[model samples]
Target: MSSATHRTAEEIGRTATGPRPVPPLGEQRFAADLSHVDTELSNGLRVLAVRKATVPLVELRVWIPFAGTDVLHPATAEVLAETLLTGTARRDRIAVDTELALIGGDLGAGVDPERLILNGTTLASGLPTMLDVLGDVFTGASYADAEVARERERLIERIAVSRTQPRTIAREALQKQRYGDHPAVREVPRAEDVAVVEPEQVRALHTASVLPRGSVLVIVGDIDPETIIGDLEKALGGWASDATAARLPALPELSGGNVLLVPRSGAVQSQLRLSAQTVPRTHPRYAAVQMANLVFGGYFSSRLVENIREDKGYTYSAHSGFEFTDQNAVVNIDADTANDATAAALLETRYELGRLGMVPPTAEEVESVRQYAIGSLVTATSSQTGLAGQLTALAATGLGPEWLAEHPARLAEVTAEEVAQAALDYFAPKRFSGVVVGDAELLAPKLTALGDVTVGAPAE
Candidate 1:
């Protein structure tokens, strides 16, 4: 084992034939058809159940439209979600916990500007017990005063800290800039607002907002699809209402404009966020647009990452992807960079955007991203939890498992020319507007000089 007897690392990696050629991808496999039932219960809840039988566990996802226009809606909604599973008339917090623990099950609730989501997991044998517990909460949850007081204080403290984070500040600024006064801009409630939220207010909000008419429930795991529907009907039978769940108003379409510069005095780093409107999943050109996105910055090997992160070292991470709302979708590009590199990073990002349209991705690039799109879809849906989540998202927009099963073929049929056309049509630099969070005095001169940038007041 002398040093001289062993080859160096470089020599070991190379051969006399000069490095190896990358193997071509094999034939892509499509997802198999799953036995599922999609129907509506008497209580007005749409239920989708699939039999995966991969394990003894069942994954549950419930999505309810929870939009509101009251001034205190966000604060009241936050408190409601915090205490939703804390108690019911038949079970207190500990009793609820014990019942679920005995059956290897757990349930939680969360809310945002658009929806209230409840996620749960349980042994397949415990499915009926889980449904009964869910029904108990839906029908008679007593939001105790003590529980409300304690959770409200904790939420206030967390909000105080979250509002101070750089990313949070940038997100708020971007939302305001892009959507103006849309209710979707109200993501985080104010601490003062939470402090004033009384327990009765939380209870009233729960009774008024958490309806079943406009909601969907998705279940995937070891079970019979047909029999499970009857079981769901029996369990959620009494939780009915004549009113439909509230839905958020449609967001105004985004158009290209100047980037806003929000000052964060003495910051050592900066946040770069950019967005533009795009086609929804149901659109005919969605497949092509998806491929174009992957080639731009949706994955690690994208052109934007190669330019800024690997070659220039301007940032540690950079990404571009789509965000879907109701029936609309928008593409977002984001990167965090050192203060010194902010201006140059912005320049390069715009440069790549312009170049993408002028010089589109080649056939090889299209093929690489195409395989990635299909492979990722198949891989993501291969599990019970993953498939449930995918179906839930699709269900939110009036789609079902059928759309998920047919997506791979759509990606396969997208041509390189179609991808190129999507790139030119959607990724143009002029079609984006966003905000940069940094020290304005330092970033202003250079950013303003870059054109299409305006400086705003310092962040409070």
Candidate 2:
């Protein structure tokens, strides 16, 4: 072809009718009617098994409430999660790995102040073997002395590095500022604490905290929900418990006040973390709040991003989203800004927040957010792993697949008036309080000049 005959890329994208008419989005679809079983095994572990035959694979998620008030609980829990799959009575560390590998499976565990989570995947046909391994770990894991020692040392080193991270510093300050002495504030255990955690303590903590009565297991894959329940019963039959898992103490309701400015002596950048209490997923008003959140700062095109990130260039990223814990929920807004832009970033963030409620989202804004919300939900649950994750989270709060299936309709039904009302009720500037972490000398003057900001560190 001659060079002259080759059309440019832009010309190829255009037509005689001018720019092509963008095709309208197809009708939004809700989640399929999943074949599922939501029932409690005799041992008291709630089992939620759903059949989504998208592929010949299975995804598993287990959630167990693991809160504690013991001073060394966090460190012990951390070590326990690392060593949980190291060995059971019937299998040692290498043996456990070999068995899982034979079945194309792998399992891992992690713990936080709120819960201990174990998630994994395997070939669908290997579900029975996977259940067997989980059962062994739950019922009879021997937190071997060597394994405990190794992981504890590694955890101590990791904690040392983590505590120095800006995000970690900001998070700890924010938690303390918000929750005071609540155990939930103790997210990262102290390095000193991990150093002193013994194998005996890890074993004791596992025996007491890793129970079944109040925990939930979610499995999604290409299997029969009805028969899978029987398989689970057979596999985890002996892993019984009379006591429920420990639940974290309820957090005090948050009321907006001052934003604490925590000094990080030489930091060149600042992390602005703001939070406000809000309704949980099961709340009737959550759909409206969800849309309101997207319009404010939940997505790339939100008002906050448009103002501080795109226009003013104060931040490269700014985000707002909800964090759910058991039955409680709160919205968190965060941005990392250069030291010079820190105070201005906070000011613009609050400005957008106030604007969201006062001006509210227009019909077009409402529709855009609504579509985004529904589309995100659908995309998130389209696969087995995604569905399993969604179910595990919902099951922790006593919900099931039915709730997931109906959420799209709920979002679609949310009106512009409702979203605006949610904005006013939830996104008011006065309804938020948080921490700004940076050099006190650099940020103190401008941040203090802005009212409702206090200088100094959060209380220990």
Candidate 3:
């Protein structure tokens, strides 16, 4: 009722009743003995296994390389992965999902940067039944034309919606600009391409990528790894090559720098995206670059947040990350800001980039970032679903299932000097390529004055 009364209530609420934990200063250490990263296989299927006794749940991600990048049909492998769970020989979509619901089981598959993931989680006792059902889908799914068409239409609809999101649209635009001549530049699959895919095409794609030209299975949880591998060996041993021809798409080389701005008239906000080629996971600089990114934008407490949000209140979010694929490496920077402040925000980000390389982090900053990163790794295996995704994806990338085990040590070895070096090498503003999605006509002039800018075609 009174200003003094309101102030008193607010102050009381702000006072801590107990000693709550302060979030660690930097990326923290991950713990949980990562000693045994058991790897082996039966038949042609690769098996990566990790044991986590903390929970009764088991997570399985059975990946098939058949999402057919090998066959030159992007997204078909993903479409196939999705369709398999839609139905099986013994059940339709409704029956399949219903079966999962009744048992408190969660089962699904998806396509990520490098693999088509078939993943699920359930109690240890349910492993056998769960595996059997998954086997049926993986081995004998009915990829009905009608289903594929339905999925195709759905993706097309999603693309239309994606166009309206400035951040998503800008990222895609940046990809195109950076990879002007490379296929790795294909961000979202073209909607028109989906209309041309039939059930036969989907099957062909699956036969090549998902059917094990290069595939692996990862299991983590309560089960015995050897026993599970034995069973898988027997179940999958008979399967042979689909004999589908596969080839790698040449990765795109970075074109001389370019900036693209897409206009959205009368808009309040602008989305900024920056991308450049990056080092692979196994590169010597990988750890250092990764650590630098964490300090810059990879974490909530990084320089991006410190400047963009904490210091200026320009945006609630601004961050960066890198994703490595079999064919290429990519680093991405994203942020949203008012149209009027968009170019100014870009200028500030550029300065932060310079500082990341030129400045040495305080000891406090280094420890805090380490704490956040490592601690998150420890609990990763706690979730059966997450563990499954990690293992399967790692296997797909030619990394062993035990990859998670090495993360803490690898990250721990990264030094402040290395991080600064990585920043200096990889985060150069001159190498930066970007897309600004806003009212481009009005926004373009503001940006061109800030840096080299080219306005892209207005969205349809």
RMSD values, in order shown: 1.9, 2.1, 4.3
TM-scores of the candidates are 0.96, 0.96, 0.84
Q: Model 1 — TM-score against the truth?
A: 0.96
- Judge candidate 2 against the unseen true structure and give its global Cα lDDT, from 0 to 1: 0.91
lDDT of 1 by residue, 337-405 (tens): 998899999999999999999999999899999988988888888888899889998999999988987
* TM accuracy, model 2: 0.96
lDDT of 1 at 121: 96
Model 3 lDDT tens row, 1-460: 9775566545555546754345554543332243234444434566776666567877777766432333336666546765877886688888877777665678877664345666688778777767767766766677887888888788778877876776666666676666553545455666677667788877766555556446667777887765777666665654546453233355665543667787777878988888777787767778777777788888898998889888998887898988666646778888999887888888888888878767866666666676767776666654656666666555655876445667777878888777777888887777677787888767888788876778788644
lDDT of 2 by residue, 222-316 (tens): 98999998898899889886788999989888998789999888889999999999999999999999999999999999999999999999999
lDDT for each candidate structure: 0.91, 0.91, 0.69
lDDT of 3 at 288: 76
Which residue pairs of candidate 2 clash? none
Q: How accurate is candidate 1 locally (lDDT)?
A: 0.91
Best lDDT goes to which candidate?
1
State the lDDT at 272 in candidate 1.
96
In terms of lDDT, the poorest run of 10 residues in model 2 is 22-31
Candidate 3: deviation at residue 281, Å? Answer: 2.6
Error of 2 at 425 (Å): 1.0
Q: In terms of TM-score, which candidate is stronger, 2 or 3?
A: 2
